[model samples]
Target: MSQADKLRQLLAQDKLHVMPCCFDALSAKLIEQAGFDLTFMSGFATSASRIGAPDLGLMSYGEVLDQARNIVEGTSIPLIADGDTGYGNAMNVKRTVAGFAKAGAACVMIEDQLAPKRCGHTPGKAVVSRDEAFDRIRAAVDAREEGADILIMARTDARHDHGLGEAIERAARFKELGADILFVEAPKTREEMIQICRELPGPKMANIVEGGETPELSHQELHNIGYAIAAYPLTLLAAAMKAMCDALAALKDDEPRTHLLSNFGELREKIGFETYYAASERYSTSRRY
Candidate 1:
């Protein structure tokens, strides 16, 4: 099945999908190895890993699309891309959605946050006006309708500035605008989360940013709260960072950090050396380049 079709099938199931977001091709491959049916290309993690920068709309459309293309090429599972603010106005939103679809994203998430938008849990985040917000999603839906062959996930960061009520209102309108999925970012409490789900329709996504505004609820708790997808955007990135730091600290103290790594064979396998060698065997001998 097509990636978008697969995403639709998964979302149709009445279950809470625990998705671990990925930064790069290797991370995406590892997520598939761990048996996840879906994932997201987290802008925050990709910005940190690729450019050593924060996700304050610093990465351009080309950069994010290139990263997403690499990830999608390396994995079979469907990936939802983070298309922050659609990178410009309504026309830009359409182009961003279509580009990501062509890049093999199962879905492209278009948010209503203003230009140079910061992370959802970060300070100083603001969304555009209501008409502009709806226009963004409308453009995205238009892109999909014009043969993009991808889902449009509408996101609203309005909870930070306006209130939970405003966030839900935007998400509801997004659903009406033909968003396949809805995300209302940074709801503060469980009660607020529950209320957001209670009011918003369609398959809703709950972002679980550890130590951020939203409470890190368990998958069952989120499922009970009516969340269709629970996205752990930074967990893998943060854990990888912690491991690197510990290994560096051990090296500074002249201690072996072997325990922090997978063994040589397993590492080679994870890196696809074995698979590469096996495939190379198809060639009986060396051929001229």
Candidate 2:
């Protein structure tokens, strides 16, 4: 089966897809090795990792695609890309969606926030007009061929700008416009998270964080409230950042490589030399004379 079909089937079984947001090839490999069912190629993470900038819709289409392609090649898991604001109007969204779908994304989500938009959790967010955003979704849904399983996810950053009720209405309308998934982003409290969940059940979701603007809830807590999926956008990136910072700090005091062997095996094993050599040896042994 195609990757899209596999993802759809997994979601059909009401399985809670836990997609860790990955920024680069190494992180993607680490996640795949750790046995995640899916991946989220986060625009925020990509922009931050690649350019050291926040996710303010600053990167061009090519920049985003380059980073996404690297992650896609690094793993076989189904990925859902964050196609922020469709990069422009309906025509732009069409191209963006097709590009991401062709790049091995099972789904691509575009939000309603205005161009040069801040992150959902960030303050002073603005959204496009309801009619305009709806048309964007319609255009994207129309662009993809039928029965492709290239899911068109519609996200709204209006929860913080508008109110929960307005967010719910926009979500319902997006659903009416054939959006496969609805993301109501940046709920600040547990009560807000529960309220968002109670409002939109089944194939609708809320972005969860570890210590972000939203309440830090466990996967089970989110699933219990009828949330379809919980997109953890920064846990891995943040952890990696912390670990690297600490390692650098250790280097200032003494030889950082001195303890590298203590934590992981020697450099060669850590870099998978043994795995490659063993595979080579096995192939050599099994070769025909």
Candidate 3:
């Protein structure tokens, strides 16, 4: 079966899937090596990794697609890409879904935030009209009908601008509109999390942003609350950033903590050096140019 089909089957089973966000191919491979069945291609991590910018809708669809392609190539695990606001309107949503599916995404998440969307945990966020949000999801569902098995995860950031009730209502509507999964982003309390799962129908996903507004729950807790998937979108990025900063600071202090970093051979091995070497040996006889 295809990776998308595999992901669908996995979601169908009675268990919670924890997907850590990966910004690039190496991280994706590491996630697979860590024995995860799936990984999320986060826009926040991608924007930060690619251009050192925040996730304020700075990265374009093409850039995210490139990153998704690289991650798909690097790992066999299913990837769910973050397609922020579908990169435009309903037509854009359709195109975004098709493009991500073509680029090997097992699923794509489209949010309801307005243009130049901010992070879900950030303030000053605004969502489009309810009709517009429905249209975007409908477009994505239609796109999926055109021979792409990619799942559509409809996300609502209405909880910040609107209230929890509104967020729950929007999630219900999104589920009715054919979203394979519902993500009500940034629920503040544990009660709200339970309420969301109890109220919303079908498969549900939860976002666990460290130090964010949402409460960080364990996988079992999330499963008990009826969440099929829980995504830690910035955990890897945050860890990587802190490690690099500390490494730089140590280098400036003349401490040069080389042991803290991966060796060159190990890095090469992580990036599939052995696979390339085997391919070269199988296809060629000599190394002379």
Candidate 4:
């Protein structure tokens, strides 16, 4: 099955999918090895990992597509990529969706945020007018109809600037425009989250950023609240960063930091070294003509 078909089947099942977002090829592989059915290439985490910068629209469309391609190549599971602000106007939205689809993304998220959009939970975030927002989704749907073979996830961040009602209304129209998924970013309370699900129809995604605006509900809780997917955008990144910092601190203290290390054999296996050597052994005496 196609990645998009796999994702659709997963969503069709009556359960909430727990998606741990990825920032790079290695991270994507780790998540897949850990048995996640799907993953998202978080712009915030990707920006930090790739460029050592914040996700305030600093990474261009080409850079984001390259990252998406790397992550998609590293795993067999479906990937949903963040296509921030579509990187330009309505036509640009189509191009971004097509690029992500060609890169093997199961879905590409296009938000209604203004040009040079910032992180959803960050300050200074603003969305464009209603017409422009709808136009973006329309273009994305058009791209999909034109053989992109990817899902369109329409996101709205107007809750922070306007209100929950505005965000819901925008997402509703996006759904009408043929968005396969709807993301109302940064809903601050459980009540608000519940209300969003109650109001919107079809598959919906909840972005759970650690220490951010949304409530950190359990998978069951989110499922009960009617979310199709619960995405933890920064959990892996945060955990990895903390471990590296601690390992470095122990190194400074002249300690081996064995507790901070994975078993060498397991690491080698996870990195495919063992598999590579085994495959090489079969060709050890072979000479190509």
Best by TM-score: 1
lDDT of 2 by residue, 139-220 (tens): 7787665434488888988878688788888887888888888888887778877776676645866676676787767777
**Order of quality (TM-score):** 1, 4, 3, 2
lDDT of 4 by residue, 23-93 (tens): 99999999999998999999999999999999998998999999999999889999999998899999999
Model 3 quality (TM-score):
0.96
Per-residue lDDT for 82 in model 4?
95
Per-residue alpha-carbon lDDT of model 1 for 1-289, expressed as tens digits?
A: 8899999999999999999999999999999999998999999999999999999999999999999999999999999999999988999999999999999999999999999989999999989999999999999999999999999999999988899888889999999989999999998899999998888888999999999999999999999999999999999999999999999999999998899888999989998988887887778773222
**Model 1, residue pairs in steric clash:** none
Clashes by residue pair, model 4: none
lDDT of 3 by residue, 158-187 (tens): 999789999999989988888999999999
RMSD of 3: 1.6
Clashes (backbone N, CA, C under 3 Å), per candidate, total 0, 0, 0, 0
Clashes in candidate 2: how many? 0
Cα lDDT over the full model 1: 0.93
Report every candidate's CA lDDT: 0.93, 0.78, 0.91, 0.94
Q: Using lDDT as the measure, which candidate wins?
A: 4
lDDT-better candidate, 2 vs 4: 4
- Can you rank all candidates by lDDT, best first? 4, 1, 3, 2
Cα distance off (Å), candidate 1, residue 188:
0.8
* Candidate 4, residue 40: lDDT: 94
